[model samples]
Target: MTESKAPGAQSSYEARKPQTRGRTRENTPLRHNFWVDLKELIAIPDVASRLKPPPKTNKRLGLRKTAWCVFHQVVGHNIRNCLALGFQLDELVRGNFLKDYLQEPQGALTTAAPTEDQGHEVPIHGEINTIAGGFSGGCTVSQRKKYAKGVMIVETQGLDLTLEPDLVFTKTNLRDVVSHDNDPVVISMVTTGRKVHHILMDQGSSTDVMFWLTFNKLQLSLDQVRPYVGCLYDFAGYQVEVRGNIQLCTTFTSDAASRTANIKYLVINAPSAYNILLDRPALNRIRAVASSRHMKMKLPSLEGIVIPMKSNQKDSKRCYENSLKTKRGVCSVTIQPPGED
Candidate 1:
């Protein structure tokens, strides 16, 4: 038997019916796009490379019937099938990282293939046939050879290529250089204890050249030169092999003082009237200043005195005439091999 209730008290079914008196409305749920957001985030250039693979336990999860892509965090794919890798590679190429590496030309890549002389095969940059073996997908000979070749190319680009500026000028030098000059400023210098005349002071040339006839007359032996197998091109667009470089002590003397430098002369087996061509290196070493108006050169001596060497105008004109004659005579001269000369 229950006690009698108060007049204000309500039953549970009667209270619920009053709360539900307002009619029920239609349900509108929001759409979840987790996979799409994840894909976009992974495709970001900076973020693509840093994305790591999912944990092994997550990879082996039974949630998906097939594999999963950790990058997109979606099923039915993996990191190997990632679409962001192609975009990242394209970005690297456009940014010049790949262009610089592929464009450098100084490095020599040698293949293991033997020649008739059993010499090391030099791999040309673009020729695929020069590879040691046929191209295939595996840890094969061709792949290893190519890998080694690439490594050598990268290693050769280090400190050996660095060069410093050679500034050889002074305030007091070239104070009276006049404009509109036509004469070539040629001077004399001592090479290997002998006075060498008709030495052309060529500011345009990049190398110190010694003609074969003059080099032979100087009595310099072949063994004294370090073998240089590179080619040198002249102003007339003629290409020839640089025989070698022989080091010599070149001296410039005047009434006041004298200067000496160990100059490396590139031996060129060619016909030229000039005995020696004093190019930028020798001039820079001596700190020489040339003046066509004055028809002389001022060089800094070891004793701190400036020595002025007078130019040989007569010899310069004679050499110019001789060179013209030689050029006219050999208009269609055949270039022979180095050994044939």
Candidate 2:
């Protein structure tokens, strides 16, 4: 066999950032997520023992079913589609074998700002155009008429929707988040290479919104704000004035996997507790599913991996408390010094 079939020593594996997203162009054979994560999680001696065996329902009855299950070692259901497996996985994710995969946004990788051509957007540099609260002032007649005409549909051109990963919600996801039944899902997101706190996942919103104070805090260039044509409504259906809109990439992360999506946010010149509000459109664009009850968000990452992230319970309480202050005309924001970020 000479040197063909024999290896004196193997080179150590180096984990590198993806050179190109899909169909990697680099000559390197291994991928960033090349390791079989499930297998690794299961390989742990403690984890392998902690996992309960598959139920009797997973056992194949005859030769008709071809969906093979790893847990049952049968053909009743596909391994990925197995509910028992997903449940156990989510359970283990909380504080067991899968804990290694759970991580905060601070540990995740963040990409730079988009280089795509931003349309000719007339940026407004002024601080506050309306009241601090979003619903305080209504929109103008012209804005109302424009909004009445048509709905603005954000185009999805650069989004990578190649893989469809399984998203599941069970008792495991609701473990610690549903105690008070008053927790609002608040999670930090990496936007423009910065960890932005108090990001609210508001599914009721038709479009994403960014507060003017938050926009300024991020130190984002005013040139990125595009003119938003339509008007936005408040809780009473009264049109609320919007400052402008900007498209920024926000990363949704879970344990060791993360996914980035370009989100078009309508910047509102209102002071509020929340820095940004992720709307239904943004969720759909990211292919994300949020469970307010569980206070968790899960998205499909590249290579069909399910990325799961949890909300900050303390931050959620803080945001809501601040929101209550805003409702009572007593809102306050901590001012950062010149040297601080």
Candidate 3:
């Protein structure tokens, strides 16, 4: 007889031994297969949900077509017959088959007759024969192979498509130049009142504005012209001539507002034949500025010409502020009508 061992002694001792470290488990990083997931996710559904199909023309038509093709079997027909009878196929399978069939062949000779068979001479002009047969007649194996190969060649060579002709219209961006003859500052004296067309308010200029055209149109002569000298600058930092001067009374106005001003014309000698241009001096005199973005004018008295600010409001603000500051408080005095005065 042996003293009875303590009941739980062996079990407790075994538990304390850090349990024979069976192979240490390693954390292998998961390898993701994007193509595999895409394939599985787009696979057709199982039979049951597929059988009870929905209407054809609605949003679920694709899904319904897919389900119908998967679950509903055509007992007595091949794929061609099924297609002829208007049976839909799963979109994935159809698209895949189309892509593969439509793929341009890369190699020169895709198929040839079995050399062992001496009786079967391969036709050299297979494609022409098939075309002559008008596609309805079954194409010979050789012909089909040639057509596929030729089509692939054409596609791969990028020679099958015709180029479209360019149909764009081109125009010149003429710089408005004010000369002694065609002063930009124009005065339209009508029954409504005297309106000043400040050509200088247009920045796409190489010269300034005056009423020379208006003066000529109004039958005003050069006798009123006085000797005047003022330095004018262009966008490219080039100085322009402001030699001879002619004074006139002009009225300026907009639909909702109006103003009158005394316009002093400076002779401008420009290269091109432009009618009138409002140079910086005339712009400064009328307190006007041109906004390139908005394609409008801003006058001191009337509502400034509103040009569409560009996409960034901050840039637009900067442009407006810069223009205003550069041509500060300079303005022409509004003159009264001849009879009224």
lDDT tens digits by residue: candidate 2, 1-341:
22221222321222233344232234112111113455465566655665666445533522325545566566544444444444455444432334345553323423222221111011223345322222112134444345445457566678554678679999977777747556788888898989898988877645577888888889999899877544544544444556788889888776768888888887877657899887677888778888878888888886788888889888898888888776432122111112211
Tens-digit lDDT track of model 3 for 1-341: 32333322221111011122222111111112122322232242431222223223322212122332222231222212122111122221222322232233322212222122111112122223211211111124454456667765544445322322222212221123211222222222232233322223433332334534445545656677676423444433444444466656655555545545665555544322223445554555656554443333445443333211112233334434444565332222111111210
Give each model's whole-structure lDDT.
0.53, 0.59, 0.33
Root-mean-square deviation of Cα positions for candidate 1 versus the true structure, in angstroms? 24.9
Candidate 1 residue-pair clash tally: 0
**How many steric overlaps are in each model, in order?**
0, 1, 30
Rank order by lDDT, top first? Answer: 2, 1, 3
- Residue 214 error, candidate 1, Å: 0.6
Candidate with best lDDT: 2
- What residue runs in model 2 are displaced by over 4 Å at the alpha carbon? 1-162, 236-241, 328-341
User: Best by TM-score, which number?
Assistant: 2
Measured on C-alpha atoms, candidate 3 has an lDDT of: 0.33
Better of 1 and 3 by TM-score: 1
Off by over 4 Å in 1: 1-181, 328-341
Every candidate's CA RMSD: 24.9, 24.5, 31.0
Which 10-residue window of candidate 2 scores lowest in summed lDDT? 115-124
Question: Could you tell me how far off, in angstroms, the CA of residue 307 lies in candidate 2 after the best superposition?
Answer: 0.8
